[model samples]
Target: MPLRPETARQVDALVADAQSAGHVPSLIIGVVRDGALAHLAAAGTQPLPDADLQYRIGSITKTMTAVLVMQERDAGRLALDDPLRRYLPEAAAAGPVTLRQLLGHAGGLQREPDGPWWERSEGVDLAALLAGFSVTKVAHPPHRVWHYSNLAYGLLGGALERVTGTPWAQLTQERILDPLGLHRTTYAATEPFARGYVLHPWHDTLREEPRTDSRAMAPAGQIWSTVTDLARWAAFLADPDPAVLNPTTVDEMCAPVILSDLDAWRGGYGLGIQLTRDGDRVHVGHGGSMPGYVATLAVHRPSRTGVVGFANSYGFRTGGIGPLGHQILTHVLDVEPVPTRPWQPAEAPPPADLAPLTGRWWWMGTSLDVSWDRATGELVGILRGDRVSRYAPEGPDRWRGVSGVENGEVLAVLRDEAGRPAALDVATFVFTRDPDSEP
Candidate 1:
């Protein structure tokens, strides 16, 4: 379905605001809904008069890299938990940093090991870049905390190269871009790329910024794409085709792994995407920032709605893109905004038989609390430190929660030889009921 006129106006208003702010020379915005390009608009200016010029998408490239890694995993070529050293022996000394940790930004690595290479244009050999690892200290133990690190993704790029014996750029093209028919998207070195611009902080001049050669950090940030191309990418994310990424795998990528409360934006970090909540809606996507450009791409997966925005000026920071994207979504959906709320399980009143699930669950070495409300006849699982959530009875010994991070998921309690509830499986997390609780 096409976007309503009001939604179009909202997009135009945002572009106009950026233009009025005077730093943005050009912007291309696109919206995709239900597997189609619902709307696409280009305002301001591109160096040339053509509409096909490509802009550097920056860290958005990380999302693509992540998807490729997931593809490799799906093919049984790799595993998310596989140690980086499995592919690159040199990284063996870096300890037990796994590919999963890198995807989640939980692999204790520096934000940028060699510093700001884009601004200085200081190039380093691949070996020197890797050797700098010695100076790179882990901020926290693996998976304990989320520390955004460009170097970790750079390492992942190296790991992918070692595993596939191909460059990261080529891997992305072969695995993702080509399959999706994104003819206009490619690495920066590829032709027809837009020249990024940086507005002078003090002066009213726009200076052409040097294009970065992100070979070292290529996987972390180095891809050129157009609004049209990105819309297609967004569509895939909203409703993935198994040929691209298994729907289950895509859902896993969107699942929140680390919680964050920054500014007024409260959300979590998924594999390569940011999991954000706007009132009752949840969105998954990533933003991009390079020397002279800032871009945002986000999608409400359940609604099949996505918004893509790009600006030509760098150093222009506004509380990231989540808020603006959310506004756009709200306009499109024509829904009233509500306060953000954590996902909660449903409640069942007393007197129903609740003997099936009474015990414990474990995921990643953490135990989850499971109990049954005998009076209400409901099964509940507490995500360790998380608030209690009620599960709705599905069918004999099966139940499902309200589906907020774990939507469409079913939990089943396993029975022992004595027909006692001994283990419970809730989607991905598996829990073993306490032996003593077993009746």
Candidate 2:
């Protein structure tokens, strides 16, 4: 569905304000809902003739690289817990770093390679980059802390190459980009691409920044993408299609693996994805920055709503492209909020065995309610003023709590000698039909 006129205008004004206020050479913003573009707006002048101009997505590329790694895991090629030395035997510096640590930025590898600033200079090939690794690169012990490491991703790319017998870019293109129909998202800048620029701090002048290939470190941050394509990618992150990645794996990638901010959980690192919090809301996505380009993608997973934006100029220190993108999403949410659908009766009746289980029961004189969840086909148990758990059927008259405080505990319905319902025993905690009834 199309966005409301007022909402669209608000988004446009936000983008326009960001471009001028940030002194950005050019900027593009897009909002997506349920895998569809709801709004797209561009500000300032794009140097390219085509409207679909790609901007260097920087570390957002890491998210795609992480997806490739997960794909390998899903196909049984490797495991997340597998140590880096298992594949890249030469990476003795961080030999204990597992694939999970690398993905979640807990590998303790240095933030950059040993050579000159790789982003500003030519990048080395995989062989040369790996040759430069040393024990010093292991800034912290494996899994000690959350440290952003472009070098760690570079090593991961090498691992992917060894496992797939193909370049990381090729694997990503075939497995992720092509399958997701993100043709415009590429490792190299295609035609009609934005020319990155660095705005002067004092003077109102601009200088074009050099774009490096980033070669071996490309997996860390080298992809270029347009806002439209990124919006679709963000939508995919919110709602996996199963063709690119199974919904479960996608959820894993978005799960918080470590805290980026120790004081409070305002920021966190997922499997190759960045996590941010706004008030009580938590969002999943990634931010990118090359020399002169900056971009961000934020998705409200609950609503499957995403906002993506990119700018050509490398400006701002505190609230760069990230806040700009998040602001767009926040505004859209404020203007056009999503309403939760009201609960309704299910069409199918409860399973015959489960039918009698629904309703109020008493456990140790405390009231509990059992109800059937048709959505998941599990029996939900709510302990009054305590906890809630989902129970999955185990066998005849037996169920197992799959979640909550009673997780992994067994619940069995006991019957009298006449085969009539008598009592319930959940991990030895007896429950009766009547609160006043004795055990």
Candidate 3:
């Protein structure tokens, strides 16, 4: 469905104001909902960009690289805990650094490769990168802190190449880009791309910035993408498609590995994704910045609403274009909130074996209610009124908590002598049919 005109206008005003006030040469944005582009808007100087115009999407490339790595993990080709040196022996210095560390920026690697600035200048191959890499490159002990590392991704791409026997670009193209139908997203710039430019800090004048192949560092920030394609990608991140990547693996990737902004506690880094908070909503996404280019992709997983934005000017400070992109996401949610769908009744009941487990129980002398969920086909535990958890059978007389409290913990069934249902033992706490029963 199209956005309400009032909603569209409000979002447009935000875009126009950002363009005029920031003096950006060109800016474009796309609002995504349920893996579809719901609206698009553009504003800037003369000749505003379209949804298809590509912009260098800087470190957002890391998100894709992280996805690819997760794909390998799912396929059993690699594990997150596996040491990097197991694949790339050259980096024996950070030998203990695991793939998980590289994806989460917890590898303690130096921020950039040693030599000149590769963002503007040409990048070297993995061999050249490894030659300069030493123990010093492992600046801090693994898991010390969240240190953003372009070098870590470079090493990941190298490791991926060796493991899969496939080129990084080709592997990404086949695995992620092509499957998602992101035709406008590419490893290299295409024609009619947005010319990246640096807007003078003091004046509105623009200077074209150089674009170069990141080579081995391509996995770090070499992607060039359009707002439309990026919006779709953001939507995918919000609600992953099982055909491309396992949704569960994506969940693992979004789990906070460490907090990025410890004080505000508003920002964090996941296995590979970036987590940001605005008011009460948390977005799973990443921002991109390269010379003369700024871009962002943020998605609200609950609402599955997202925004992909790009600007020709790389003029923003530490945040780059992230603040604006995040604001746009928040705005869309505010004015064009997703409509609620009517709930449907279940067509089938839970398994017959679970029939005995449903209904009232008691835990720690507190009343507990248990029911079967038709939607997820799991057992739901409601304790003390509000604590809800979903459980799935793990073994005979045992069920594992799938979500909410006691997640991943086993709920062992204690049967009566007659083999009828009795009390449940979970974490030393027992649940019985009698609410008055004391522990």
Best by TM-score: 3
**Which lDDT tens digits does candidate 3 get at residues 278-340?**
889999999889998888889999888888888988865234468888887888788777898
Query: Sort by TM-score, best first: what order?
Result: 3, 2, 1
What are the Cα lDDT values of the candidates? 0.74, 0.86, 0.86
Top candidate on lDDT is: 3
Query: lDDT tens digits, residues 1-439, model 1?
Result: 6666776777778755655565567766777787777876666665531336688787888899899899888889999999887887766666888898888888877677665564326445456567745524566778777789888888888888878888888889888989999899977545666677877677767888878676767888888888778888899999998888998899889987676555655687888887778888787898888888777888988778888766667745344343555667667766422224586664643333453445556666566776766545556667765866778788987888854445467887678899877677777556664433322
Candidate 1, TM-score vs. the true structure? 0.74
Tens-digit lDDT string for candidate 2 (1-439): 5689988898889877877787787888888987888878888874622337888899899989999999899999999999998999888767678999999999888899987999889899998998956788888987789999999899899999999999998988898888888889888899779999888788967889998898899999989988778888998899988988888898878888899998977999999989998887888999889988998999999888988888887865336778888887877777788867898988988977677878888965898788899988788888985689988888989999988788889989998898765777889988889888776
What TM-score against the true fold does each predicted structure earn?
0.74, 0.91, 0.94
- Single out the weakest 10-residue window by summed lDDT for candidate 2: 44-53
Error of 1 at 148 (Å): 0.6
